[model samples]
Target: ETLTIKTASKTYPLYIGKGIRFQIQSFIQALEREFSSVLIITDSIVEPLYLKEIESSLTDFSNVYSYVVPAGEEAKSFSVFYDILTFALEKELDRKALVIALGGGVVGDLAGFVAATYMRGIAFIQMPTTLLAHDSSVGGKVAINHPLGKNMIGAFYQPEAVVYDIEMLSTLPEEQWRSGFAEVIKHALIWDKPFYDWLQAEIHTLADLRDEKLQFALAKGITVKAEVVAEDEKESGIRSYLNFGHTLAHAIEAGLGYGKMSHGDAVAIGMLFAIRVSEEYYGIDLELQKFRKWFRQFHYPEIPKHLDAASLLQLMKKDKKAQSGTIRMVLMKQIGEVETVKVEDELILSILEKELEEVQQ
Candidate 1:
């Protein structure tokens, strides 16, 4: 199946299904643009698995070259970003050059940022090899992490197209599957009450994601994201809804150090925390126990006891959504309805303390 992301910045296609990655040639041809050279930026883990195959598919199109960064969150680092740029320069890649991000979120963000800044800009495609990339790859919100915060350095650049071959997800470990579904859950929670209900009713375990059901969930999640991006391309308004769980999620990732915990796992905890905060602050029932049970079935890790609430609060204050040292969080008024609130640090700290104490138990 295919979904088109129409943002004010650019419009692109998201091709989702089995074996879509192998069909890169046709998609590249459909672009109707010629590239002087092509750089396939991937992670070390994906390099051996899919690089040669993607390179072979693009051989007839241009001088296909490959650069592999260390896999995982660290790949989205300034050093690695600079190295890839150096590689691109040494290879004489120009404005006509095309970049292919051939891995998960880290590679997509790093490569997309490189394309966004490389010589002012260049064309790129996202060939997401992991399930988590389903959300990160489609939206064009690409960036590297900062020591202070996650995705502090980035851009809202769109891709030429995104090829998410479901078959590529076959090799992902169970943890990756757990990680990717967090964003899918976020998409449902922030909008589409029906979709949220569907997930609660039908999806019970990782093993249940198969055939059309997996594709349906993925396409559904992507559709929500596409529509949101279309409405607010630069995140000046409703697009922040997409960050429903991300405020705490990013803080956790940065607090624990990136790569220590998967993005999706962090988000699962963040969503749970948001649900609790919503319940107490907004006086709404978000089925907190139901979500907790479901998360347990998938084995999401808990927030580390060592991550002090004060430190996390400081990190969150540095979030892009923050204003004048105040914390703004996306809170659910109800499932499918959300709003951004400038939560007081005292309230936030109290909730964090309670949540952290509960996590310890």
Candidate 2:
């Protein structure tokens, strides 16, 4: 079955079915009726998996060139970003070329940023592989990580189309699924209370990744993201609520080093911390213990011991959420809603100390 999600700014169709590769050529042919050449940028991990099938499908319509980079969060670097630009230029790529990011978040971020910058932006498509990409690839927020921060350098350039094939997720490892589910949980906590309740009760572990749960999770997650993007396309105000756990979550990723604690795992811990602070300060009577039970059911890596409250606070201060050297975070007023509030630095330290204390013992 196929569904077309029409945002006010863009209307693109999402086709979800068994082995949909055969239809890719016809879809692009229909799109290419108004466009020209195509540029495909993917990652090493994904290039080996589904790159050939995509190239075969696109070979007939227009001249297509592919650039494969190293996978993981590592690719979201300035060096690689520049390299992709150089390669695109070397290929004689023009403004008419469409950039297809055919991998996960890192690939989307890198490729999308390149398209946003190269020759002053070009049309692009997202062929996402990871469940995490369902959120990142759909949104136009694309960029490379700065040495001092995560996704610090980026732009709000929306994709021309997002082509998701659920079958692409099957090859992802258990840990990879765990890494991406944090965003799923974020979508639920920030916008869908019932989805959050269902996730807590129905989906308890990574083993449930391939189940019918993904359809609901992916659809709901993308819908929440699409709705938020439609309302606040530039992330000027209400859109900041999407960063519910990401303020501290980004700090954890950078402080512990990115690969040590996957993005979702760190965000999970951050979400727990946010709820703890919310209860303490706002009297938000949340079901913290239920979240604790749900979280512990997964194999979350422990926070790195060397990362002290002081260091994490320093990292958080450097984050984009910080204003005039003060920390701010997206906090939940209720399960299905959130707010971006300015939080004092001392409170952040206290929470980190308490969390670390419990973690150590």
lDDT of 2 by residue, 1-361 (tens): 4555555566666655446655676666656555567778999899899999999887575587888999888899999989888888887888888888989999998889998998999888778888788788776889898886678899878777677888888999887798788888898888889988888877877787664677777877888887787788777887887888887788888876678777888888888889887777687688888778788888776665667999899988988879989888888888988888888887888988988888788
Q: What is the lDDT of candidate 1?
A: 0.89
Top candidate, metric lDDT: 1
Provide the global lDDT of candidate 2 against the true structure. Answer: 0.81
TM-score, per-candidate, Cα-based: 0.94, 0.92
Pairs that collide, model 2? none
Candidate 1 colliding pairs: none
Estimate, for each residue in 230-344, the C-alpha lDDT of model 1 and write its tens digit.
9998888999998898888889988887778988999998998888888888776888998899778888888878999999999899788899999999999988999999888
Candidate 1 stretches greater than 4 Å from native: 146-149
Q: Which stretches of candidate 2 lie over 4 Å from their true place?
A: 1-9, 30-32
What is residue 71's positional error in candidate 1, in angstroms?
Answer: 1.2
Indicate the TM-score of model 1: 0.94
